[model samples]
Target: MRRHRYAKIVATVGPATNTPEMLKALFLAGVDTFRLNFSHGVQADHAKVHASIRALEKEVGRPIGILQDLQGPKIRVGTVRDGRLDLTSGERVRFVLEGSEGGKDAIPLHHPEIFAAVVPGQDLLIDDGRVRVRVVGVEAAVIEAEVITAGVISNRKGVNLPGTLLDLSPLTEKDRADLAFGLELGVDWVALSFVQKPSDVIEARGLIGDKAGIMTKVEKPQALDRIEDIIRLSDAVMVARGDLGVEIPHEDVPARQKELIRACRLAVKPVIVATQMLDSMVNAPAPTRAEASDVATAIYDGADAVMLSAESATGRYPVEAVSMMDRIIRSVEGHKLYHSIIAALEPGEEETPPHAVATATATLAEAIHATAIVAYTESGTTAARVARKRPAVPILALTPNVDTSRRLSLLWGAHSVRTDDVDSYEEMTAKACHHAQEEGFAKPNDIVVTAAGIPFHTTGNTNNIRLIQI
Candidate 1:
């Protein structure tokens, strides 16, 4: 089905919406992509959900994107003497690297990487920073830290060390296993978490190859330090605000979100603004006013997609959440301020033939009041380039490869259609007009812009642009 909005919606699937009926309903409501979070479910369960999404895609006759989110690593505190222990402020706590039961002063934390990298004066935030401590002395096998924000520190509570770059791989054994399963299952995108540098993207690329798009989750301050390099290496980027907010100051998240969105758009890569867009909808039927404004702000900043995490994965009102986000995006995109705001941030194109032609195609289509811009792409690059321009009209992408079409579903303003390949210019024109009308994007007497390459089915050779009368 053709959506009325420009920015896409990515909804995570879990206990609440894993069934075929709910999946279809969510898709109908406005979910362009479905994320199978590997953190919570087994492979068997995810396989069933993946099969269900493909079935729905067939029934609806539209390309649906599937993103596999790998749970990177679980760094937490080891067990203490009891299940929990209370540490008072201004008291000393000794964290040992040995695996042994200890009291409040001698807690066992066996992560060698933490001890190898952590230094004095660095803060250790526990249980989402409710309990904090600062390192006073670093030893070979023990770390002496004084409590800063004293509270009950329990077993397996997550640890966050902000501003300290740990010398560790982003992927763990579990993530490697999950990646293998997801790639075999034919997922469209793979989101890498716990990324700390551009090398993380390169490492994932070595494993993922071209099987699926590698989307780096920008959640750490170190990732932001080298974000431009990471963005260039990654096929896509995700503004993961949950862990990011935990790592950085809360006030800085809005500006970081905007910066990442702008960088992704400039690079012509699809960016998804994820985590807690409509979190209150996890139990409620509707979202709060603040949540609605949060979603609208992302669309106004020109994000390719805004995602729903718990709101759809385990929420009581999954369909309502998707519908509300869809309405919010449409409302924002329909406003004059949104158009002005987004258009004003359009980055300068590179002085390359392909970039110039792509920018010109978008400009020409909008200037002529075309109904849509039909992009004939082989690698989906041409369509993605035009999408980066953020034109006013819709982008109808025609591709022979189903994978390309499915991946394009996550791009902004793109309605991807799988069609047969065209060889000649005349055949290209006929197919473009036919599919433009067939897809309900155009009708008789409507004008459409066709972008194709001279070598026919080549990639990144977008040197030709034509105006067609439908």
Candidate 2:
């Protein structure tokens, strides 16, 4: 089934939506990509989910992308004596380096980088800022902090050091193992969490090589300082606003998000706006009015895709969440102002072959009122270039490689179909027209625009465009 909207939907797969039948239902409800969160599942669990996804893909005859999210270096407090402790406001606590059973006086701090990086007056947010603490003193192997907000301090609660750049690599030992497993599974995308600099992206790229596309999760404030370089190095970027909201001022998130989307558009990389789009749907059958508006706003801001986390992974009503998100996207895309908003954000004149062809193809499509823009791509670059233009017409990308087709499914306004490699321009055009009609994008005598490389089956050679009628 074809999705009605241009922007894609990424759904996380977990226990609630891991079954083949549930996955099929989600795909039918308009989930273009499945994210396997490495933070929670083991290799066996992910393997099962991956197999089920492939099975559903074969049954539906559509390429569904799989993204493996690597859990980066996550610092946490060590174990407590009673598994939990209650700390009151203004209480002084000592975070010690030595591993010891935490008591009312002191707790174990495993990461040495925290002691080395954090200084007096820096805020330490725990459990997503539920308990805030200010560093009062720092010694060689100890950190003295006073609790600003009173809350229970549980065992292994997450630690967030705001405004402190830790001297630690994004990839931990666990992440390397998880990446190897995900690569062996042939996942289409690898999302590296907590990317702080361009070097982090380069490191991930080195490890991933050409096996899978690297998508950097921009949650750290430090990433914004060098976002241009990060976007240039990454194959894609995720606007991960969950922890990002914790680190930075909440009011600044919207502007930062817009900046990231614009940067990715200019770089011609697929960008995903993620986290809490439909959070209320995790338990309830419908989303809040504000949540609906939030999803629509992301679409209006020209996001390539909107993602669902717990709402689709462990939510009680996974299918309902997908359905609601689908409805919201469709309704927003149908509005007349949607076209105006997207057209306003189109990229300006760029002196690149792909950019020239992409812009011209979009203009010609709108001028001739073509039914669709058919792109024959091998690396998905041409499709991405056209998507960057944000054309009003639909994009049908035909690829011989299944991986390329699946990856393109996450792109905005691009519908990917796997087909054989054509040997000539006429054959390519004929195949495009045939698939366009078969895919319900056109009918007999309907005009369509075809774009491909003159030298058949070559990548990055989208030098020809033709107008043909089916």
**Candidate lDDT (C-alpha), each:** 0.92, 0.91
Q: Tally clashes: model 2.
A: 0
How many residue pairs clash per model? 0, 0
With candidate 2 superimposed using the best TM-score fit, by how many Å does residue 292's alpha carbon deviate from the native?
0.7
**In model 2, how large is the Cα lDDT of residue 179?**
94
The TM-scores of all predictions, comma-separated, are 0.98, 0.97
Superposed model 2: Cα runs more than 4 Å off: none
When summed lDDT is taken over every stretch of 10 residues in candidate 2, the lowest stretch is: 346-355
Q: Write the per-residue lDDT of candidate 2 for residues 1-470, one digit (tens) a residue.
A: 77778999999998899999999999999999999999997899999999999999999988999999999998899998889889899989889899778786778889999999989999999988898999999999989999999998899999888788888788999999999999999999999998889999888888999899999999988888899999999999999999999899899999998888988998999999999999999999999999999999999989999999999999999999998888989999999899999888765666888678977887899889999999889999888888888888999999998889999989999999999999987788789989999998999999988777778878887788889999
Model 1 TM-score (2 dp): 0.98
